[model samples]
Target: MLTYQSSQDISITPTKGQDKPWLLLLLCCFWLIPGLVGHDPWKPDENVSMAIISYFMRHSDWTVASIAGVPQFSQAPLYFWVATLFVNALSWFGVAAHDAARLSTGFWMAVGLWGVGLAGRELFGRRNGRLSVVILLGCLGLPLWGHHISPAVVLLAGFAWYVYALALALKQPLRAGVLLACVFIVLLTGASWADALFAVLFAIFLFVFPQWRKFSYLITLITAILIAIPIAALWGYSLKANSSELFQTWWRYYAWGPFGGARSFAVGTSVGFLPTLLIWFAWPALPLAAWSVYLFRKELWQPHWQLLISALFFKSLFIMLATQQSEALVLPLLVPLVLLASGGVDELRRGAAAALNWFSLVTLGLAALVIWLIWIGLVTGMPLTLVDYFARFSPADVHWKGWGFVFALLVTLVWGRVLFRKQPLGRRALTNWTSGLTLVIGLLVGLFQTWIDVGKSYRPVAESLSAFMDGKHAQCIDVSTIAKDPTAALVYFTDLALDARPDNECLFVIRQTASKESATPEVLWSGHRLGDQKEIFSLYRR
Candidate 1:
């Protein structure tokens, strides 16, 4: 029979061959912080969020979140609040507006990792805690969404803090007040009322287990509510005072709105599809976490399991039931999932461990290799097929960066060494998996960032539209109506207030009309078609 020992039996100290936690952490930073810094805020969330921050910077108003002059109620001001600080602070160093704003995500991403490590340590031990952070670094969804300047990413940080602070409520009961303060911060920083509600529910669920029904735990939760409500009320009062219309709009649209679409609900209801989703969505961590939960079936009563499951339950419930089912919704679940996955790392069998190692070595190794090949093809057209393929999509003016190649090559070399190194099954395998994942992410960022920028950025379209407006000397433009992408791009490129709603005073109007119809409004004296007949945009002088 397979036997298991307590985490106390394992050596927390790293041997010479093993990947040190600090180095693993540094590698994660390399994977996370690099591309996020230099890139423009790519559409849909990044640009939208950054635009709001830019608006706040120009106007210096925290009471209402907006883009251009349009008040946006979909998100809370907390994300923009933090991002605005970076936007102004980094401006001194000559960072671009979007790049400076995105600094918030980088800072919070690090906090999320630190919180994951702490939760793991509190639940398991120091060794598992470090390993848990590694596992989180290797998660499939993080690289895509973790760096987003959206409220969802900020919610992720708040969720991580909630997990860490909750663990503290039981372990260090004397610091209940401190833990409660963290809970208050979560409510204040979260994107929506739903997120704050989930946190409260998560706290209550922790005390549901008989063993955790202590006076300190109860008092901490009660205090958390008392602390959180007043803080939330203060923001609410300010919002109401500054813009009552926005306050009502937020309450009516989002506060208690029925959430989730057919696709998202399908994930919750359909047993058949969930496994498929989990396979790619949660990936290596989900499988290992499932295995760990199965092995520790009798120990589900523990506070760690209780808290993780509670958080997972509420977050998943919201994702499945909400009106919009974005992949970004999965961000909040990563911390608890990583902590649970770390529990199974030590109990993993030799064959299973070997399988994981080989999987990482092949899959991530191949991914890195492909990214390198593409990067080379982009720089030099020796491989005519890849060159032709890329030329069809990206501009012919794309240039090679010598520094990108050097950085990518160095990271790939380190990845190769980790892959080939002979080491024991558990922690070594986990660390290598994270290192491989980081290397692949690094390759994409270092090599393909500009390429990605070409496709995703709205700057070109924005610039094209701006060219039509240059001679007119219009102070502000009016968008009769436009989609999200074009609207955001116009705001950034034009550097003018765009009114989408009906207004009589605008000197110029940009509208998206039917292909057969002229984009020009009838009331305008004259208009200029922004693009060719195939494209839809017209700048009209009223």
Candidate 2:
């Protein structure tokens, strides 16, 4: 038989030793602040994000988003708009445009962590809220994707807002409705939600869980949709008002993409997405979250547990089964999983606790050591082979920065101090995992930032291409084979008006190929980065 949670049972009272705001703040700073500002826009995500941001900086057009000079219909303007603001705001303070745009991703990520933490508190307990954040910080995939420029992270913040708002809906129906309305607008406006329909349906679906079937909850659900309508319509109206072509393109392509995957799961899921890939992607949190669900098997119908389960089911139904697969799709899973994992920590058995503590120690400890050794190699010339190995990634003029040593040493000392402190194994395990992750990422970024930046940066290659084009006073150039990622990078780095579409009639052509040398006699320029063999771009006369 199911029972309702008593008012007292759900009340949140933070105990002094159980959680501390200062400690949580410190942990967040340690995890988020590193590896954010020290590098150039790396390819895959940052290049495109910065490219879009760069586009906004030069053009007064905010209604239509574009990559280079070509109109891009699918991208949501919200991210570029936000990123552009960050770049402009930070430029007066001496931050570079790319670094400031990247910081926009960090800003969204911080919001996500806050929402997730607060949601955990509302759904589970105050301590669990803090633990949820730690669990999320300890996730394997976060450090990379969370820091890079992508609206997916913004969507993540929206999901966190959704969960947080839903958790609030139980108590404050009207307020929760208004909050959910804002969340709906945010999701609907961004590229994250394919359509606003599912978000609406999902609010209604919550009533299926018996605990939330009351009239107030019904009012909450109704209020959300009613309020959300105007904003979504206004956005649509704005789009159509700006240009019918852009609105039609968005509705046709971007809005319906998620539902289109239902045709066949065989197109990708089982074969392409190995189960272990996501297992490690979610890491220790997944296992703990699963254990928590099973441990409370009898209480699975409880509102908090049921809410998380339903949310997970709702998300995974679309994301996990989608035809397209990227590691980022699994990020939203972390919010609920980490929240669940926090509950699991409360009931953590002695053996499991011991195992978790040792696991964090062994795995992250070893990783930290390896990073330190590599940092040492990069700084001092004792290990010739190792130094020589990393040296090839950057230009010959690039030298190790002294600031790397200072930053790395401070991180190491702090890590060493925390490593010996006594605490519950579960809390200790979470702490060690996040701390070690911070230390490792900190060392890499602080010690080898220039090397990593040089290897991945598009600046060198874009500049080379730009210089040749300038020397020739190039016009009507072609970009037939270039991928969008590099094209965006070229737009950002060179400010080139690469709008001309490709055809045989063009006077100049720019194509990217794996071949090191162009076979054409009309070649004007050919180049790649310092150690890259995969991409070699060439420009030539037709």
Candidate 3:
């Protein structure tokens, strides 16, 4: 039978020791990989979010809707307020709206990565922390979701860090109370019911766990409530004033309908391994995590495991329970998975006999394969069959090029060196090299795709619209058929105030057919044709 040693028996000192140079290299890579992927502002949700931020920035009235002109109470306004500050600050430096949005996304994403690394270091050792950073940087879904100015991903990242800090607080007294207070303040200001529910569950887990029934736990709990009250009140005021419709819509969506239908086991449970693999990339990690839980079930029965498990369960359950579900919702759950996977790594490291080492090698090899597949699909384009199906609707051609192939080869080679090197470098060195390579290569690919190629497509349209609005002194502009005409982009890019009653003022009608017989606004400006149609603008003085 296999025997295990207690935590006290194991040497606390890391095998590789401190590696500052490697840690810096890993951090740089973490920033670069996600930064390079470039921003794809495709979702309407993104546009809506930006508009909300713009409104708040321009009016300084969190309680009133000056831009979208509709009462908006779908969710809490704390994220919008924070994003608004960034937009307002950047505008003072003469940055354009789109650039501001991208910068904001990039900033939050970096913060999230930092939190991931810090949390990893605290829970696991330095080696596992470095490995966690690499895994997060290489995650495709994370970067993709980060591009949209959604609070969900950011909130998830922030909440995960808070939970990590909370765990530490349970162990330490005075310092823990302060950290716990901070966490409560942030969560309450965000006012996401999801966060609140998770916090309550976490408190209960601490209460039930034998190890956490200490004075510090009680102190932290009391401080958390005290810190939360004011923030919650502010959020409540904002909701009551600006977004009643949003609240109603959200409730209806989640309470009963298709969203509810999707959550049912019949649909959600059916989402098998393929979609999971595509989303997470490290598919085997899930099983490894489960195995680790079984191995360390006793440790998990204590407060630390209870905290991590409760956070994971509540986040997943809330998301799955939602009427509206998307792949993005699962991104938050990845944090706990990363922590659990680190535990698996720890188990493997502790039992580093020949068999376990071979298993680690195989796991790393599988991870490399997934990374290569992602690089090929993202940079070079998909197979001919996939291209044929998807290319028809896409704005650009779908074809693999030689440069992308070369880039992929380079990445594979670098990864191969890190993995297959005969002279066994310690875990720290391996993690640094792997993470650094991922960051540098990933950023290069992203910059080429986003800043050079894809960015060009929208720049001209945004520029022309901005110029037209400024030249004509058009304060009141109304857009029809916004989805096809890029009107929403124009509105956001120009920071133009949306007219609540466009029919009562001078209106700029986009995409309407011009006929001599028709009685409407005269043509003000027209530009580049998309597909078989040209984007036309008509100015009408009402």
Candidate 4:
């Protein structure tokens, strides 16, 4: 590792050997486990995951990606298989299907945190590694997207492990090869081949960098690729053998079209606005990552800077050229940025660090209090000021004082204890920030999980639609205008027959619209989640 100028005074705290990795593990658990379960499949992503997993559990189809008996766009499904494995394993212990499926997030997020911490330790020192993990855990965007069902999270794990394997490639060839094998397996199997291509690109770019331009690194990459080949090939062979047509469809997914079919572009409005998205989503880490570069302006060519900066630059280019954006696409960039920012923590001016730490403590401390107060209003309906605001989410009939309350209360107390403790010097500010972020998420999910679910989930609508169907002879229903979120939820939660055959003798149609429209025949059902304004569903009999 290249030592920083004026290193003695600014370094984190000497070269501590291990830095209590177990503590980091415990923090990861705290950070990862909270919002994993205890709620129904919510909105676009989780509902889609539940639909796919539910189908897989019943049919055990290894080669095809079908949801509700309809084919999916991207066919490579190593990620879904991992989640299925988790669901199957957890079912023996009687866990709910959706909850079990969500456990996959915790498992992969842990893998990511492990890789991130190890890379920090490898490239810098133990303290910096732990600090890196802390800073990442504290980032505003991670907790929001990390705990959900998305291939982006799995790709995140791959990136974290990729960097670690890259760090160890030349020196610890054997271990690095094993880690890189896992990374490739992750990139190859579970997610989109489009996103995985960048991992491979990053690896190739490493060869072009001075640090990775060594015979041993080349050997390590080849070994890992060789290890990953048989597994990927097996998946391909199975899919091809199962049905040649299915394999063809899977192969042409993004190659033929950006989002599963031929399309000019993908989701999000524009690629140009991505940096703006990164501004909030990447949070404190993004700025610190830039600060790391500024601090070492003279050492841009150093091996560490070159590796980190090149990774960032390549991912930036990939994000722009890919023509799609989300919190997920922004995720891989964090690994390099956090690793880069890990060193910046130490070099931060003492006064600035102190001011930032106190500011975090005060802001987070107040935020926690407000969360508790809002939670209290949710339970007792006291503090009438908040009651009106909370009503927008949940009905007045919704009231709870369950075990989640006790759990959240304990968490808030723990956060409070940490906040009021003696002021921290260097790394403690990050600790406080991450803890506060976790606390805020915990309080919201624990206290008002019911409230949020009431608004976000399509369970109520699905159940109502199912009841409406049961009242009459079961018949195929038209789903011409229904959005994907409700569509997936209905498929997962109900037994209604959904189809889009306009010529069929279907009497019922389910359509979503911005404003309710009058149907000539008697309407079956018309409603939406109370807080959702983007869509309202109406079931009509034509």
Q: What is the Cα-based TM-score of model 2?
A: 0.92
| Sort by lDDT, top down from the best | 2, 4, 1, 3
- At residue 349, candidate 1 shows an lDDT of 85
* Cα-based TM-score, every candidate: 0.88, 0.92, 0.69, 0.91
lDDT value, residue 360 of candidate 1: 79
What is the TM-score of candidate 4? Answer: 0.91
Error (Å) of candidate 2 at residue 486 is: 1.1
lDDT of 2 by residue, 276-371 (tens): 566778877888889888888888877888888888887776675565666766677788888888777756777888888888878888988887
lDDT tens digits by residue: candidate 4, 284-352: 788788888898888788777777888888877777655545567778889998988887777777887
Candidate 1 lDDT: 0.70
Error of 4 at 93 (Å): 2.8
Report lDDT per candidate.
0.70, 0.75, 0.53, 0.74
For all candidates, the clash counts are 5, 0, 8, 3
lDDT of 1 at 316: 66
Q: Return the lDDT, model 2, position 493.
A: 80
Checking candidate 2 for backbone clashes, the offending pairs are none
Candidate 4: worst-modelled 10 consecutive residues by lDDT: 255-264
Best by lDDT: 2
